[model samples]
Target: MLEQKGNLFILSGPSGVGKGTVLDALLKDYNDICYSISTTTREPRKGEVDGEDYFFASEDEFKSLVKKDEFLEWAKVHNNYYGTPKKYVDKTLEAGQDVILEIDIQGAKQVRDKFDGGIFIFLAPPSLKELESRINKRGTETKDAIATRLENANKELEEKKNYDYLVVNDQVEDAIKKIEAIIIAERCRL
Candidate 1:
């Protein structure tokens, strides 16, 4: 009788804020939400698959896609490119499947302008000190890289006001619970 339309929910924050961990737990619990995959020009990390974790692309290929207007939102971050594909997100939403994008603040801004009524959620760390410790524990970054990330984290934190919701990721389970609540509340909204 009625056509169903999906709402777009964007989860974004600074690097090392545990966005992936929180999203993984949330996805495990929610069966209806679709996680939109991002395309990136960066090299894949260990254990990352080509199409699962990210659609890894070369700089040239990424630029080609950009030229073709294939991305809903794209941004250059940390010396590499990342983008959300327009077609996939549009198709899934049109099919009445809720789509979630875990992205950075820059890309989130781009999506905000394009996707009206999108629920923007910003994930934050408990503190800068704790965020640095989390990054250090990863051991994936050089000292210089860690420093740069911390610097960028400050700038990203300033943009939290742009989001409709803010979740501090002190614990992964707690973060997932809060996000789940948001999803439920939004779904119930008239």
Candidate 2:
């Protein structure tokens, strides 16, 4: 018998919504799910490994892959190119391993348009004030950058209406449980 293909789950949220933390926890407990690594033209940060954190590429290489249609979705953000490659995702699913794509709103939209069956979950902060606090706590961005991110996050929050599920990340464990429930429910659907 042919192996059953696995499902695609796209998790999206604004910056500082703790999507990464929740995802990390989920993956730690679930060995069946595969996290899709994105390719980027931006330089790797300290301790970020190639092919694990991101597939770091040069401008020419990124452009070359774009032309060859190797990406499921690609976008230019903050003047850097980032994209999800199609091959590994396809192969993993073919081998019956579930795939989780942690991407931005633009890339999520692109995936939604191209792939009709995937689950799209939007992760929202408990409140804008909480979101602001979380972003500030990161201490990585300048004030101006933080303001820009907040503005963009407002726009992204609006897109939640288009998603299949809306998860509020008030507590990390609660959010992960909600997502786990969604996955179970989706899997049960005929």
Candidate 3:
């Protein structure tokens, strides 16, 4: 049997769609899949580690990377810069390990333009009302922030048709199962 080339899977969705929760569970069960850590200009939040959660970069450092074209995809989101570094992802995929990237819609679109072969999966909330509820439940955002997020969510939901798969996150377990199936099916393709 021939060794298969590793696949790049991009997971994106609205802010409150529980992408993080589903991904955490998925990673716990899957050993072959690798998570791609992104770089950001935002300050590390609460318990987020420097290299694990993200590569925390100063604005100047991030700009230097941009000039050097070190990112597969980068964008300014919510007033902070976020980008996927090209090195680790390229190295992982070349080594035949599947790499998964969780990014926003803007970065996903940028990836689409550059890497057409990657699998794009959109994690959608069960409903907009439910999405709003989830954001509220987080209790980390102000009313104005919540409103802004809802507006952005509305815009993102429209892009679902462009993605290869839509996994509605009504339940975390079910969503993970669906995404796992997607990975399996994609891997099976010749």
Best candidate, TM-score? 3
lDDT of 2 at 69: 88
10 residues in a row with least lDDT, candidate 2: 181-190
- Candidate 2 per-residue lDDT, tens place, 56-170, comes to 9998999999999898899998899999998878888888888999888888998988776899999999988899999999999999999999998998899999899999999
Ranking the candidates on TM-score from highest down gives 3, 2, 1
Candidates in order, TM-scores: namely: 0.85, 0.87, 0.88
lDDT of 3 by residue, 109-190 (tens): 9888878599999999999999999999989989999999999999999999989999999989999999999999999887
Model 1, range 131-178, lDDT digits (tens) per residue? Answer: 999999999999999999999999999999999999999989899999
User: Which 10-residue window in model 3 sums to the lowest lDDT?
Assistant: 1-10
- TM-score, structure 3 vs. true: 0.88
Q: In model 2, which runs have C-alpha deviations exceeding 4 angstroms?
A: 42-53, 77-80
Would you list the clashing residue pairs of candidate 3?
Answer: none
